[model samples]
Target: MLRRRGRLPAAPWLVAVTLSALLLAAARPAVGAAAWCIARSGASEKALQSALDYACGPAGGADCAPIQASGLCYLPNTLAAHASYAFNSIFQRSRAAPGACDFAGTATVTLTDPSQLWIMHLPFISKHCRAIRNTRLSILHSELHV
Candidate 1:
């Protein structure tokens, strides 16, 4: 292969990829402004249950009715799902206070929208999906106005 004096074949695509990655990174919210809280993966179900209880209880005071039987988010019916919902609820309620997302290390804060994750995984035509869509829209509206 003969090298051109002033041109590199790979340089153009490399530059384009670098710029695309940078733009995507810049479009996301800052690390310090994580907007959702969820149960950390690898966290024990027991710990999640405890955190869920605390969040829905008086101390954490998260609105947890949505995870109740027949409630909008009741499907999935797993510890992690319910805990994530409760964690995010309290986190949002407290305006993302310094320690609000800790949950004794069982929870983590992230910029990703947890509701959107749920919506994507569930069947699009399911009743649960519609409920979550409505809920997510309302949450987004509140966030925008705030």
Candidate 2:
């Protein structure tokens, strides 16, 4: 006689997926994992726009390709949003220097991962975002200066 096997129930699978997502959401940054960027609040629109131009252009020395129109970070287009991306790129590339994120008093550093808010919606770029954050954190821990 042959025996038949039953398939697992969908409820359990759903529960497991939910739990996994929660765990990932709660994941903490590695020790000394901090990053800096321009703050979207408290700055005048004109100042933010000027800073964005400088950051994406020459002064800040960051690649603003991703924040350009038709780019992954271009959605919900706003001066502050685009500026934040550009400022973060400069901050990460400049090794989080003391003033790299300042943008003339418009920026600040935070322990929380900015990518969590910025790139979370981009499934294709999520992994790349984590990689960039992780690399920056690791570099931050190793490099005593800045």
Model 2, range 19-126, lDDT digits (tens) per residue? 998898667434556765655578888888888788888766778776666565565476766777778888888777666778877766666555566543332124
TM-score per prediction, in order, is 0.60, 0.57
Worst ten in a row by lDDT for model 1: 118-127
Off by over 4 Å in 1: 1-34, 116-146
Q: Quick one: best TM-score, which candidate?
A: 1
On lDDT, the leading prediction is: 1
The 0-to-1 C-alpha lDDT of every candidate, in the order given, reads 0.76, 0.67
